[model samples]
Target chain A: MTNFVQLILNLLIFPGGLFAVALGLFLMGIDRKIAARLQRRVGPPVYQPFIDLVKLTRKEMVVPGTAHLQAFWLAPLLGFAGMMAAVTLIPIAGVYQGFKYSGDLLVLLYLLALPAIALMIGGSASSSPFGAVGFSREMVMMMSYELPLLVVLVTIALKVGLATGGIATFSLSEIVQFQLENGALLFDYTMLPALLAFLVFIPGNMGVVPFDIPEAETEIVEGPILEYSGTGLALFKLMTSLKMIVVLGLAIALFFPTPLGKNFLVNLLWFFLKCLVLMVIAITIVRTSTGRVRMDQAFKFYLRYPTVLALISLVLTLLQR
Target chain B: MKKLLQKIAKKSPWLYRINAGSCNGCDVELATTACIPRYDVERLGCKYCGSPKHADIVLITGPLTARVKEKVLRLYDEIPDPKVTVAIGVCPISGGVFRDSYAISGPIDNFIPVDVNVPGCPPRPQAIIDGIVEAIKIWETRL
Candidate 1:
């Protein structure tokens, strides 16, 4: 009973729900501010995303007459719920131990695909031509990125499993525990390719520039989300921010789950700082410096580069064993 | 609580642009206003959104021509309620150089209620920014 209550609290109050949302929005705000500065412009305040969400709630929601109302309404909630669940599964080094399950990493792998699936469902259900186009592009992007991500996860799992005298361990806690006993995989020369592949995966999964083909504003006018307004739009924004936390948090856990000190609050802040640094390196800088790529080009790029990079790590991990 | 939300909401006003078949001059200026660091509208918490549904302020450029009058009106209607419309360039107001042309159908106020007018053949970026500021004020009242 106590465990159930703790799980609920973790999912709703701390580390997963409220805390994750706030941190995600803050990271997004910082990304925008830094991007603007990169372009020599004065950006919106760091709290701009929070204000935008507030404004979205006040506006009227316009549902397209042609849209499939059920799917259109349910898509955002599906993605949001998935992220909420995924966040609880992530261990926060010294602060939180995460959900203790043997195959939590595999569950996370499946959960990570939920938002893209939500996007595809929403786009197709919208009944707009641009939405149709977006749906196809989004599916292709997902397929292209998923292969590399699967390889990367397997590589890490195998590396840890072999080192700890097993075949493969899909438990996130075990991965963190191994790292704590030894050191972070981030410093491991063999894992560098996987790390780099994960970095590339960040922007693609987050749907930023060079990989924002599915929601290309210029060509498709925001595509799948074009028809969403008011509260529906706000939900989508919240989902994206939550996704930021999940992806960044997952990256931190997998590669470098090191805590600063023994204090819980200090470790929590340190984790946030790491997320911020990772966001800037992987998402912000890449987005600011690059332009959008064609959907086919992006598909080809992901397949050729990150897949090969992750595969190299997989091979190296196997060879090391 | 509603009042507090409104006050906070007033800070963000995503802008959407509609072209009513005017010459590309004003469109270029709008682009400059968005792209150039000198007249950064983002500082005002204004984002140039691609979809009308996401817009809080509609920036309509071009003289409404017979070709695009229906399309422009439809686009304007697509924007959710409590939106402020800012007519950019004299073309939207008097149809500018196209006023007497048979192809022109504007003086856009006839079709859509324009809340602010920045009058010029092609208004400078600063004037456009000023017009957007005025639109934001009008938008706040509606919220």
Candidate 2:
């Protein structure tokens, strides 16, 4: 009975629903502000995303005549729900231990793919030519990024498991627990390549400027989301913000989840601080500095660099074991 | 709650552009407002959205030439309701230099309800921004 209640709270309150939404929106707002500053311009307030969300919800929603209306409506909700649930899977090292499952890491791996799949579904369902182009590009981008992510997760799992005198572990809580007892993977020389690989994966998964070919507004006109308006667009916006939290939270969990102290508030602030630093380094800087790459080029680039970087860590970890 | 929504909604007006057959001059000016570091329209809580469907504010440029009249009207219709149209430059308002041309079809307000008019051959960035500010005020009442 308590477990059921706890699950509901976890999904709706902390780490997932309300909290994740707020933090994600803030991160996105900060990202935009910093990006504008980099361009030598004054930007909008950090609370601009929240204002945008409120604004979007109050506007009119338009459904295209040719669209698959049911799927079009369901797509954003599907992604929103998936990311909300996925948030509960992240173990906040010194705070929440995450869902206590031996294979939660594997489940998380699958959960991480949901938002992109939801995007592909939404894009194809819109039935616009731009949406079709977006769907194909999104599929290709998802395939390219997933390779490096898989290798990074596996390498971390093996690194932790071997040190603990076992085979590779697929449990995220166990990985964090292992790190807590010893030290963070950040300082470990062997895990550096995997960390770098994960850093490379962040922008691709977040669909930032360089990896935003699928939703290139100038060319594809926001692709799959082109036909969405008002409340529908609001939901997609919410989905992306929540996804920002999930992806950045996952990075914090994986590489450098060292909490400042035993106080819950202190630890939570530390976690957010680390997330901000990571976002600035990996996503904000890269996005601000680069233009969108061609789909083929992005595909080849992801396959070559991050995939190889992660594999190097995996092979080295194996040799150490 | 409705009043509160109206207040914030006014702050998040997203802009989209429709080029009726102008020389790229007006379009370039519109792009400057959207992109140039010196004239950051984003500071006004305005973003240039790619799709008409996602737009809350529409910025129409150029004289509505006869060939592009139907298509521009169709595009304008795609913007969900309660949208404000700001005609940028003299072309969209009076057909400007194209007024007497055989192919010219506007003064765009004749087809679509234009709420604000910024009239210059190509309106200055400051004038365009002022026009947008006026459009947002008009938009707030509808929201």
Number of the top candidate by lDDT? 1
Clashing pairs in 2: none
Off by over 4 Å in 2: B33-35
Tens digit per residue, CA lDDT, model 2, A1-321: 998999999999988889989999999999989988998889888889999998888778888888898899899999899899888899887788898899988888888888888888899999999999999999999999999999999999999988998998898888888888899999999999999999999999989899999999999999989988888888899999888888888888888777888999999888889889999999889998999999999999999999999999999999987
lDDT score for candidate 2 against the true structure:
0.89
Q: Report clashes for each candidate as comma-separated counts.
A: 0, 0
- Cα miss at A245, model 2 (Å)? 0.9
Q: Is the docking of candidate 1 incorrect, acceptable, medium or high quality?
A: high
lDDT of 2 by residue, B1-143 (tens): 89988887789889998999989888888896544688898887788899998898998899999999999999998888889999988998788888799999898988999999998877788888899999999999998
What would the TM-score be for candidate 1 when compared with the true structure?
Answer: 0.99
* Consecutive 10-residue window with the lowest summed lDDT within model 2 chain B: B29-38
lDDT, residue A74, candidate 1? 94
